[model samples]
Target: MIDLLKAKKLIFLLVIVISSFLIITGCGRDSGADIQSAEDNSFIMNTLVQMRAHGENAEIAVEESMDRIREIEYLMSRTLEASEVSQINDNPGEFIEISEETQKVIAESLYFAELSSGKFDPSIGPIVDLWGIGTEEARVPSQAEIEEVLEFVDYNNLEIEDNRARVTKEGVKIDLGGIAKGYAADEVREIVKKHDVPSAFINIGGNVLVVGNNVDGSKWRIGIQDPRRGRGNVMAIVESKDQTIVTSGDYERYFEEDGEHYHHIFDPESGYPARTGLLSVTIITDLSLDADALSTIAYVKGLEAGMKFVEDIADVDAMFITEELDVHLSSGLTGIVEITGPDFNLIEGENFAD
Candidate 1:
């Protein structure tokens, strides 16, 4: 996630997608317009989510959107003992009744799990808790420990039917952190749509979605994070209009122990941080959920395979940042993605598979 407010001495954490704005203005926008924006941030889904809407009822829309996100967090948060996910995990083999929202997220997650050949497994909760990459207790687990957890990390074993979900294996757990934000962002879109907002940007912990254009009618500039450089240092910029930009990267949400860095994104097969040789994978598309799932799937697939995975999908494009700081784009993203960081070489037209 990016820290857009870092320069302001306040870290507005979100995934690495930077909301493009003018630095000269205090709030990072061209603010001479008669139109105004209503923005608010709340801690939900374990991230500081912020939404800015421009319209007559922008305030009401933003407030309602936050409430919607809170509801989602209550239903799906794995850490919450009373959450539906925890209820399912706490009681295996028993179908716990869930809201359609939870069912949709799980169902969508399972679809991606199958599509990525379990690379984006929803039943990877045990492995995630073991590594604790995003937690203060983050550390590398032993081979035996990881092996033991792997037995319970099968997404195929997750069953869902009639607005309920369950796991066949006792130790299996479901964590929607991988994709819940995207679903929430889409929900926010609906909230703004109902209010008929002219334009908006939803930054749910760095998974960004822009509705329409800026107040000044300029395409929103989204900055892609540079892996080598820390947050706030942009690798590239994508001029977007009404689209979702989600990136899964190894840069943040990781811990270093003994010179080995373990990231939050785990490879289900190995039960370890994904060593895909690519620093990050970004998916740009209409739906935030699709972009969210695909970004993780592509990162787990690595550079060559990741590029192919994005290319095969219609109406979707992706950018791959390599370990060598090389920026690779899918055929669809070739001309549109602008390289802003001089250190990064835009390696377009090169055969990645070879």
Candidate 2:
């Protein structure tokens, strides 16, 4: 598991600001007359893990959920040398037997890899490690260096045989950083619900999943961070109940050199940061796993195609923040999604598509 005070996540800087990326807003009053609530946070899975729940068993529910997240980090975190993911990545082309939990997330990763046709791939580790965007060694590699690693970035090359998994190609590897947290969030939800907690707020590195309404009996109001602005500063507020709200943007993990900015989210085809002309893409959905992967796909697809891609999915909505700071809303969130960023212009995404 990701040990406390050390991580591969983009949060050490965020460590000071805690709520830098996403903020839980508008909690009215205390826990009320007779309600029990528990809230706590820790650094794990390369990001800060925050949990809050209400009910008689809120404390136990939240604690169990946090423990589950730790278990996931132990198994899935790529930086952990003994982790299942590392084992698979370290010995490419060899079927490394993984835990059911590891296999489950990897299989789902393949689903998204196929779903987006490799735009969002689990095999993006080679390029990710080469750039090292979020680490102290972060640097821009030469095109030849990028091209050399590109051959190993194909999701199609990954093969899963039941409980065992392996990258078919020798140079290929798997990194679940993109989708693991969401899976963990979904797992946390189950833990919370099983304990009979009526409400909870799970913030795994600003990727939020809220269960039930606020204590005040109103919808949970969440603030979406302004990608360029500092943390804890929000551009919009979303009212969510029993749903996951997450974003994938260039601002997450990045480095700047010679006036050029490079972020962690990569374009599988380009082998570099996605130049999708999008500042950030936020997905609001019932499943955090879906929202997490969808946000990345939409961001990599760029604004126009990304909007259309998300619109086709039923019961899911997306908010596309373009390079121009223009807020484009999917059909479902058109009239909704309150704008809180003064410099942001809320316009019809359809018109922007034109």
Candidate 3:
């Protein structure tokens, strides 16, 4: 009788293991079946825009998404003479009518600006231009030069109403560089959804937005870029479906002069690159636009305050990598984030629960 009972327990354990395996391998999908995907890439928005879809209309959807991205870039680019942002910047103190799309992005930027208490200011164009971090003319601006440009960096000075935006202060410029790519990713996701693509991913300059799971119906794996390493080096990986992942790092756009590095992200108050005790901040959420702006805000807020800020928000999780190579994740991401790099250590008990 005892032998029979032991045999039954062994069989039940086997059944549980097999069931778990089936669930993890994905339900109803042939494990060996090939998942066809169509991909396209274009250099736009000052970075490479890539899209991949796994439906019958994958090619068409990718092409349409690319076109939409270009349209957004054309409309929002601050340097483009015909762009709405440029017009508003060129005509400070004068109201300029912009397209509905431009108005939407500007409105969203203003919302984030208020939410982050102006940490993610849209009116940072003048300071960005003075630093010129990403351009061939990039250089560290003098203290006086930065101060001169910083006087015009207040987001509250910009006004938006009825599809018209105007800068109340002369020399105040609006650059959508901080949040435009996320908005573009959101736009591309809409385009993909309109085409009824079942599984698609839109990557606009590393701001990734997914319409669904991977082609194989598994969770999409996204890598958090290692700030200290070159491109493609990741410190950790996160798995998700139907989420947007964005990273704001000091390493993305910067130039070194006199043994000091100056990155693109600047502190609106100090008129200099934000020294927020963070090397990079990555945000994952349902909205690409929110993730984009929040990543920058978290980085500027520093680690302790930034982690708390992200925890207070609903339906959002973040990974903050400090300059000391310590990784801090939101409570929601404690179990979901897997550290893969040896150089970084995950801070225990640092996650805040949802």
Best-matching candidate per TM-score: 2
lDDT of 3 by residue, 14-122 (tens): 3333111011223355742565568876778877676778887788889888888999999999988999999999998999999999999999999999999999999
Clashes of each: 8, 1, 0
For model 2 the local lDDT of residue 284 reads: 94
Distance (Å) between predicted and true CA of 185, model 3?
0.5
Query: Looking at candidate 1, what is the lDDT of residue 204?
Result: 83
Tens-place lDDT per residue, model 2, 29-138, is 56444789898889899778888788999999988888899999999998999999888888877999989999989999999988888888999999988998777788
Candidate 3, after superposition: displacement of residue 215 in Å? Answer: 1.1
CA lDDT, every model vs. true structure: 0.83, 0.85, 0.82
How high is the lDDT of residue 251 in model 3? 80
- Worst 10-residue lDDT window for candidate 1 reads 17-26
In model 1, the runs with Cα more than 4 Å from the true position are 1-32, 351-354
Candidate 1 positional error at 236, Å? 0.7
Q: Residues 79-137, candidate 1, lDDT per residue (tens digit)? A: 99999999999999999999999999999999999888898999989999998766657
